[model samples]
Target chain A: MTTLLPRAGARPPGRGPRTAARRRERLTALGMVSPAVLLLLVFFVIPVVLAFALAFTSARLISPTPAHFVGLRNFTLLFQDPVFFRSLLNTAVFAAVVVPVQAGLALALALLVNTKVGGTNFFRTVYFVPVVTSMVVISIVWMFLYQKTGLVNHLIDTFSLGHLHGPDWLNDPSTALPAIIFMSVWQGVGFHMVIWLSGLQTIPADLHEAAAIDGADRWARFRHVTWPGLRATRTFVLITITIDALRLFTQVNVMTQGGPLDSTTTVVYQAVHTGYDQQQTAYASAISLVFFVLVLAVSLVQRFLTREKD
Target chain B: MATTPTPAPGPRRRTLRRIPGHLLRSALALLFVFPVVFMLISSFKPDQQIFADLGSIKAFLPVGQLSLDNYTAVFDRVPAGRFLLNSIVISAVTVVLGIVVNSLAAFALSRMRWPGRRLLLVLIIATLIVPFETFALPLVWWVNKLPWLELNGFHLALTEGWLDTYRVQILPFVANAFSVFLFHQYFQSIPKELDEAARMDGASWFGIYRRIVMPLSGPAVATVAILTFLPMWNSYLWPLMVVQDENLRPVMVGIQYFFQLNVSWGQIMAYSTMITVPVLALFLAFQRSFINSIASSGVKG
Candidate 1:
């Protein structure tokens, strides 16, 4: 194991069998990587570059007219539009609420299921069913459940014995975004729970036992040991949840269509709404560019915030 | 944390402590499963009966006149079978191609020393931070103008645009950044000495990748497959943009068809259940892999 690896530095001055082998290896590596590179360049790289370039052009999705440079026209229009502003605010609000709520809930869940008792796996599996289930499916089912005569209202009626009525959840503007936020959290929290549980497991049990021996109670041990151990998982959960919250489109597209006076409209939802539905490729690109900037800014801030103090 | 060499809690006290945990777990588990259970249960009942039973606990239980009537009605209402088949083919192809391509790239990056390897890896990983929604509109516009070479009988013809095709759905997703990262991370755990030994045995790099590295990478393969398949199967926004052909629509987009006018709750539940059950069954079957892979993806953070 102590033997030093023979790198290119180790190769004697050129034209040796080892040199030939190294060249062949490099060629094979290139061949192997090219397929992935080509695909990514075509799909991810080009499109991302296009996202930037097309933002300043008057490009239509499927038009006969060639795209012309439009300068700040799209941005000016975007600033003037109230719906886009609402969408951005809604995205921020969604992320602001979901990041903490989902991450905290997931940590709680991870701790609960991390016990070495029986049925932990069963509990984990049951909790993860919604994570595996499609958001589209969830949105549809919850749409039904949120109806005026749905199970949610019925349960409210039953619990109150006909004293109170649940609001029309997806229809009422006030409750629409909150309702979607709740479902989004429910659908995604299981994923972060697994992440947090893994982090918890990596925290050596002896630390907790040592803390316990030192008279640290449950909360004290958690604060000192468990919380510190979950730094990576916490960063992962918060960032993923925030990104996901900001990309809140499926439920909006499926359940509410960003409806009830655009209360539930998210940046991504409006991006799709304008990009695909209206075919204004350039304008949609502008929205998407802003969306990308928001994601980048938020992620950078999160990374900075979650960086290890030491 | 439970492993203690010293005097542990007495058996009665331990049981009492576990009691709260069990109760809490049971309660949380119930809360998580309730909506799915309601969807499944409601899929079988008539619309009226679904609402009728909603006032009671029976909303979640399979009570009263249960039938496959709504499931059958789902087929009558839309081309559910076509959507299912489309999603299956699209997701399956995407997963397979993704594993092959991404893992190969990972093999080259992780197992060999080459010029530009480090730069390529960083570039690929950098794409991971950008969400799909950010570039989806531009991708849509780009694909709309991109050309495809299609075979017509014996002739190869260049067809413009990939909209309304399976390739549009599958191709863009085949070179996933995270899958490549996963494979690279997994490959690093394999000792580099093995590659040298294989080279000493006169094995070519591709040979080593196929006969040695790939065969040893079952867990990575499964992890990549499951992760890739989930998004592909649940792919709504992409296909909703690209595919307008009813015959080419995936299941997630099928939900939109039910939303047009007079909405049928039972049929919606039925379709939702139909699309969701297969993924759930797959998840339960590969529960450990699903859980562990998602957990391990925290390596990025």
Candidate 2:
């Protein structure tokens, strides 16, 4: 927090060594920052602007002619497109199901491990192993387990009490997206659990002791103290999980490839499919633009709702 | 009314009560580890045996016809070594460049007195909200037209495009805003007096950065390296779009080649296991700092 800025009114009557030194410092600062700034400008800023511009044109990846502007045709077509609607719905459903489940399980796991227990690090590492592993690797491994005669089914059959049977988890349109959701929550919960654990650690032990002395039971103590203490962490985890859920591409791409009837085609997946596989750059940009706005709006709303009140 | 004398709960009873929770936690941890263990164990088993053992707990254990057949099949079916090498090169280059580029940018903003520093920082951070998928297609078009310099045998040649090259994968990711932000936050905590002291001794800004800032910022560097390395190693969609040459494809893209008709489950497991080992090893080695970094930054992996 130290002020590195030179004094505002330190001007001498004439140009001097101090002024020259100040200018040199500025030049050096710009020199150091220019490489990253240049990269971001070229890669991120330009592409983002180009994505918006491309969304208005009938652009194709392999077309020879320059793309002609098509006005709002791409957006209009997307609005009426059944597959796009399905993808949007699927993404919404995925997020709605995943954010709560992952965050809740993470919080529960955090609470469980936050206790003064032996081998806590062991459990933490074990839970977090999947989080570190690549999503593609996890998806491929889980795809094996989700097969008809796979480990999950085998487990179901072994413990079935004579009434249960394992279904084709990935092939069934009804169950495919949910199956992906299950694996995602399994893989991702540990990350948020760590976040929650850190948040829990920041809560002072004396607050719990004070609540206990005031006749608060475990549930009551959590309700009055822990939950309130973790409000900011909860907001953060919610936004991050929401963002992750909305950008659901890797699992679907690896496991189902948008599935048996586009049941698992998320917006991000649909955008990629359209852009790369179908080679409809403009349409894909339109879809991506809509998705981007949706995410931005959701994030802004979440921030507004969670903003601290003085 | 006189209360009846109740036996005080012994330490053994309290300990016994905690056992169920501990047991429950262990079971859940096993649930998390089960797939990874299954991937590793099944990698050693034949395809038929993998399916055969599926009906029992034996599927998870290293028993019944374990060998290197699946691993060999993985190598035969795909260029596993080539893919691994590509990924290693790509991730290493990205990490090295990312640390340098991002830390320098962060250093300038965090340490140096400059105009509009706060504005620049905010602008850079705002880019995080824009997901890569949104700009990915446009970036493909952009990079395809971008020029590059390549060595053709003994002659150095200027190339027109960056597509189908290692630099494409490495360069776009070099200037990650999150890494910059993390470095910036870390730099802010470093006292400015150190910079002033170094400055008084005629140390240039770059000298101060290399000699003083970076040496003291080991934790930040590790955090950024891990953060940068994970995404680069796990990158699939971008490479799939930009990289066309089989030799240039990273490990994740090499995965799709196994998903053809008559999918080789054992081979897939083998490939997955091979790819996952490096990640697990890295995490295990730096588990504390990795978790601490994520916790402090509130960034998901």
On DockQ, the candidate that comes out on top is: 1
Model 2: residue B101 alpha-carbon error in angstroms = 0.7
Q: Report the error of model 2 at residue A147, Å.
A: 1.5
Which digits, one per residue and each the tens of the lDDT, describe model 1 over residues B34-145? 8899999998999889888887888888999899998998898888899999999999999989999999999999999999999999999999988898899999999988
Q: In order, what DockQ does each candidate have? A: 0.78, 0.66
Local distance difference test, each candidate: 0.89, 0.88
Quality of model 2 by C-alpha lDDT: 0.88
Candidate 2 B-chain TM-score: 0.92
In model 1, the runs with Cα more than 4 Å from the true position are A1-14, B1-9, B261-263
**Model 1, A1-310: lDDT tens per residue?**
3434444565554446667888998999999999999999999999999999999999999898899999999999999999999998998888889999999999889888887776779988999988888888888788888898887888789889899999999999999999998889998999888888888888998998999999999899999998888888788888888888888888998888899999999899899989899999999999999988988988999999999899
What value does the lDDT take at residue A168 in candidate 1? 96
Q: lDDT tens digits, residues B1-301, model 2?
A: 1363654567557777999899989999899999999989988988899888887778888998989988988788778899999999999999999999999999999998889888999999988889898899888877877987778999999878788888889889999999999999899999999999988999999999999999999999998888888888989989999998989999989887666535578888888889999789889998998778767668422
The A-chain TM-scores of all the candidates are 0.94, 0.94
